[model samples]
Target chain A: MNRLFLSAIFALSFFFMQPAAMAADIEINTPAISAIKNSMQARHNQLAPHYTSGAVGLTRDGLIAVRDAKAVPLKDRQSVNTLVAAENKDRNALYKEIAVANQNPQWESDIRNTFAQRWVEKAKAGWWYQTASGWVQK
Target chain B: MKQHLPATLLALSLASILSACVTINIYFPAAAAEKAADRLIDEVWQVKERTDTPEPAATESETK
Candidate 1:
């Protein structure tokens, strides 16, 4: 009887501890995250020139945008818009993937904010990024 | 009454353990999250020079 009681308690504790143990890891990655990162990296080359030209800027919400539509040539503007849209979609997926990978979908906003700060921090000089006041060059 | 004691004790302990689980508020691990973000950003941007400066330790903010 005593053995059975101890076994029951141990099993219950293990079951309850699983989520806490899983939640401790915020850097967990899945195949989905890797695929999203690869897609974004491949598109970065296409977006780099626009970032330098002040046409595309990093938003405060962890997204890219066409800050100056006129900076892009009229013919290329549509393509730039498409690129921005694609980048944003990938970025959104990246954040959600990270959160879901960690088994905490509710943490998506926190993950996004962390990435937003990181993007601005890593941005090169003369690159445009957003701040609370407005868009500024980094 | 004597035979019921073991079952009662088991139920009480189980209730406390289950309640503990319900109240467990896992906070956002900000430092770990920041590190993960940096890793992904570096890859996406293909950054070579990583002169990283640690930011202020983020408070244990509840994300739930």
Candidate 2:
């Protein structure tokens, strides 16, 4: 009788609680970052010939400053530059890997350059970025 | 099997937790919507008397 009662309670709890717990509550929106991400994608497409992928990795401060504009301190600009350099290196490596993965046969440099130009055009005013002209505003 | 009861319950609990990724989508006016508004305002912003063409049907591409 006790075992039966326990089983009934357990079954009720599982059934009653399951649906509420399974509901989704995810929201995906960050306008400022989105603006930057769009700029980056445009940059990637423009630079497609130079690299198979144009994803320059972000540094610690670079990542934080992307969304929270107020977070960038004056002293962190050097860190941001370092981040840009690191990100560029990663992007270079990533492109090579992507090309290898996709087996793209030609015009890698041209595509990558186009992507870089697009990146330059779309960058937000204050984001740290590196260009052939050297590090400058996004 | 005595220990298995607890293990089975734990597995079920874990599965429930894993499966419960709740995503809520709240749609606000997107960029396209803002652009459309801008275009509409621009077209109508000029005051050239009251003899203008009637509003045309919105394009599918514009909404998207």
Q: Highest lDDT: which candidate?
A: 1
Q: Which stretches of candidate 1 lie over 4 Å from their true place?
A: A1-21, B1-25, B49-64
DockQ scores for all predicted structures = 0.28, 0.03
Q: Which residue pairs show collisions in model 1?
A: none
Per-residue error for A55 in candidate 1, Å, reads: 0.5
Error of 1 at B7 (Å): 25
Local accuracy of candidate 1 as per-residue lDDT tens digits, A30-76: 78999999999999989988998899999999998999999998999
Query: What lDDT would each prediction earn against the true structure?
Result: 0.85, 0.37
* Candidate 2 off by > 4 Å: A1-78, A125-138, B1-64
